[model samples]
Target: MIIPDWLSDLHFAFSHRGDGQMSFKHADKDVVLESRNRFFHDKGLNLDSVVTGELAHGAEVALVTEADAGRGARDRNWIEGIDGLVTDKPGILLMTTHADCAPLVIYDKAHKILGQAHAGWRGLASGLIESLVGRLKSLNGTGPSELHAWIGPTIRACCYEVDRDVADRFPDHCRFLAGESIRLDLTMFVHRELWRLGLNPDYVTDSNVCTSCNPEFSSYRRDGLNTQAMACITGIPE
Candidate 1:
């Protein structure tokens, strides 16, 4: 597992290739559960206390509470239509699965609020980050400047070629042409978006670990539909 140093003092983690397949979508239920159990246990977290999003690649951000714990730990009944989750409730982990999509971790230290998001190309275009920040503000008035964020491993521009349709969704500055290939820099897009949202650039960190380039991560672009996935998990410890 890759624990971000920027948020190393907190209970936050990004699963790695050797952490086993964290997603249940393409794996056996019991096997996936076992993997998750072991992973969470190793991190001093309880799998039964975790809440995950359905990850529809939409803009929906759900405000989670203690009652929502373990909703997706053993089954697929996660918060529906949610690509992002925000909560101030301690001990209930917010997690989202990813193959190559970017995993976002947001924390409001003053209010003790947490936000977790899965930002694929579609999710970013859908304004998922905006919705998540808005939810954080509503929860306890945590504004963009007060939020600290981390963008985890994903398919970086070096490997993320896109068609015109996908390229048009973001600003040209975040996309560039490598010869004839139009590649999009997801990290750059996310960073610029956060800056536009009024978040302090110093408080935001990007892992810069490209999933497609790094063998330690699972990449859909590299492994296709049969690829196993990693997961991003974070929470406030009691």
Candidate 2:
């Protein structure tokens, strides 16, 4: 589990498969508890304090609160029709899962606001990034410039070949024709949108580590293998 340096104070972690699959999607809820306990043991958080969303691959972004904590620790919290979650509350670990899609993390220390989002191709096309940024901005006067963002490790254009239908959604600048197929670059796409929305280029960091190409992370594209899921979590620390 690695936390972005800019978000050093937060209880954030992007876990790889070796860290133990931090998921309860199967019948064994203990898998989630055991994995989370080990990963966050001395970090002042527990698996039961986590709040997660079922990735719907849409643009719906939900606002979580103190009461929403522990809703999905053992059982699915089931926030419907949403692909993103935002919160101003502390200690409640906000998380989402991904294999190929980019995990988007955003924070505004000035307002103590934080967000975690899953941006698969569907979510991206549905305006997940813009919708999330807009909603966060509307709260506490948080603007793009005030927010710091990290585009976590995901399948890059090198591994993300798509059909014309999927490729046509993105502009030419965001994709290129590679042989007979088109490849989309979510990192570049998000960075462009962030800048267009007024975020500072310096504050936004794209790991540029391709999950499919990098051996450190898991990739569905690399094999039929799932990541145990990349556990992307962000929150305000107490």
Clashes of 1: 0
The lDDT of model 1 is 0.87
Clashing pairs counted in every model: 0, 0
lDDT of each: 0.87, 0.79
Model 2 alpha-carbon drift over 4 Å, by segment: 1-4, 25-33, 42-44
For candidate 2, the TM-score is 0.91
Give lDDT tens digits, candidate 2, residues 185-222: 87788888889888898888777778899877867777
> What clash count does candidate 2 reach?
0
Q: Which of the numbered candidates is closest to the native, going by highest lDDT?
A: 1
Instruction: State the lDDT of candidate 1 residue by residue for 64-144, as single tens digits.
Output: 899999898899988888899998888888899999999999888888888989999999998988998888888776568
